[model samples]
Target: MKRFIAVLVFAVVAFSCSKEKGNMVVKGQIKGLKKGTLYLQKMNDTLLVSVDSVKLFGDDKFLLSDNVESPVMYYLTFDGNTQEKKIMFFGEPGEITINDNVEEFGWKPGISGSKNQEVMDKFNEINQQFKLKRLDFIAKDMEARAKKDTAAMDSLEKEYKKMVRRRFLFTTNFAVANPDTEAAPYIALSELFDANLYLLDTINNSLTSRVKSSDYGMRLQKFIDDVKAQEKK
Candidate 1:
């Protein structure tokens, strides 16, 4: 009786441990994906490593589970014969759901679960406007070059610079307004890095203390220091 009770207690403890292991759950369905593999990848130091994977055969559904220490960027990569597609998302320690059609894989899919992801989606929506403007500039530049119109080419170059400055200002504003989020520092470094050093310093100084101590925040500070050192030389 004593041995049996001990075995039962051990079983209960083992089940509890298993339940507490996984902190993040990712479940999704890919329409028209008959047979393929799905990889859930995250950056481990400098390398993008696959933390979880699922092999699907004649099924369009998959589930992946892992533990995340904080809000971080993650990738959902589809391995197929003809082409490979990857979707990036800011993942947190919770359940996230994604739904996408394999036929239209390159387009943004529906993702839900993390607040950081929602912030990223909002940023992308605004960033798309700038992207369209850049495309228009590219088209006009090409046309001017094809016609050998030096005056038009010069005008277009000025307009292109104005557009770049406008985009940089918008990014800086967004970072300043959303200082508590990880996306703020990320955009300051990734999107507005080429802007004026004073503008970068402004964004960095505006971040909250908690955000300033974050991983991306520290990186951004270091980047600014490096750029200043270069300028001094």
Candidate 2:
């Protein structure tokens, strides 16, 4: 009876460890998050459902996990509906580490351990430049409108359209270059959804079969098909 009890205890301990870690292990620290509830979330048919949560009374470190069916985006946020104060990262079936300060939680987080997130980080770095230029153009346009300068307003509008086209082309090329990663489809679906069909098709055709079958990949394919069907009508 003693030997049987020892075996049962070991089994129970293993089961508990597996249950806590799950498939995707999300463990990290928010430097100033002293006492608050953190929730790990993902989209399930448009709903942001929490997979796991932890309440930290003293320590800043936390652990949350979920069984990822396939690699997708995830949100790490605090309790209640504070959507703005959260970190969004690409979640996969491995351990991911996220460390940031509570002051600038999502502004510039240091996320590692996922190849997809690395790709996203690189893309975002370049995209930020385009976003800044867009802001400058918006401010100039507003100034022109206030002064009733028709010629300046026309020039600004034309320049803005050119910048938009450049961004679209750049995004399409980036997606094509990273064809094997699931991020490619996601980039096309998110960044170039409203772009010309030709550009969207180019990115879609360049995706690898494995990535083409991913959640975002399948969604991109469906989105393209739906658009084609609409045009046919």
Candidate 3:
């Protein structure tokens, strides 16, 4: 009888322990950011951590998963900000926490106490490719226009827009898919259009808004003044 009771007690503890460990899913959208890469990191002790990143899709949704331990805290970082969420293994699965505000960087799910380093390097290489293509288009267009070659100029313009659209799609997709992150990558792609006149008409409105809006325009003017003032002083 003593041995049987001990067996039953051990079985109960084993079952409870098994139930306490399970998978957790995190989902959220990045607002006001059109393109960028979002990173999910698992904290390791002593300034070490394992990191993973997801590309943001056009719809601005992101998902991350981990096998959680009870009372564990993980961080959701986007752009340059980080938010904490305390994971409770006792609750139902599929719980969600959304980090929406980009300024204060508030968290929807509370009861979190924490804290990663490192950025995604793959996206950087792709961005370099985009810059090279953009420059090539600009130089070709300039030479064609200078020679009075209307047909070649027109062709270059069309090709430039097409290249821009492809970059937009890549950035938009990554931004939407990882809404919990920033749109820095997508914003960088916007700079490519500075040399391509043909892009102003064909590119997405969001990309154009960044270049032409009073928000950016006023800031740009202020920047120029600040630079000039510094030069004099």
User: Which should have the higher lDDT, number 1 or number 2?
Assistant: 2
Sort the predicted structures by TM-score, highest score first: 2, 1, 3
Off by over 4 Å in 3: 1-120, 183-233
- The regions of model 2 sitting more than 4 angstroms off are 1-18
Model 2 agreement with the true structure over 31-132: per-residue lDDT tens digits: 988998989999998899988888989899998889877789999988653678889899998899999888888889999988889999989999999999
Each model's lDDT:
0.85, 0.91, 0.48
Per-residue alpha-carbon lDDT of candidate 1 for residues 80-131, written as tens digits (9 for 90 to 100): 6333567788777889999998877747799999777888888889999999
Q: In terms of TM-score, which candidate is stronger, 2 or 3?
A: 2
Q: Best-fitting candidate, measured by lDDT?
A: 2
RMSD of 2: 3.6
- TM-scores, all models, native as reference: 0.85, 0.91, 0.31
> Clash pairs of candidate 2?
none
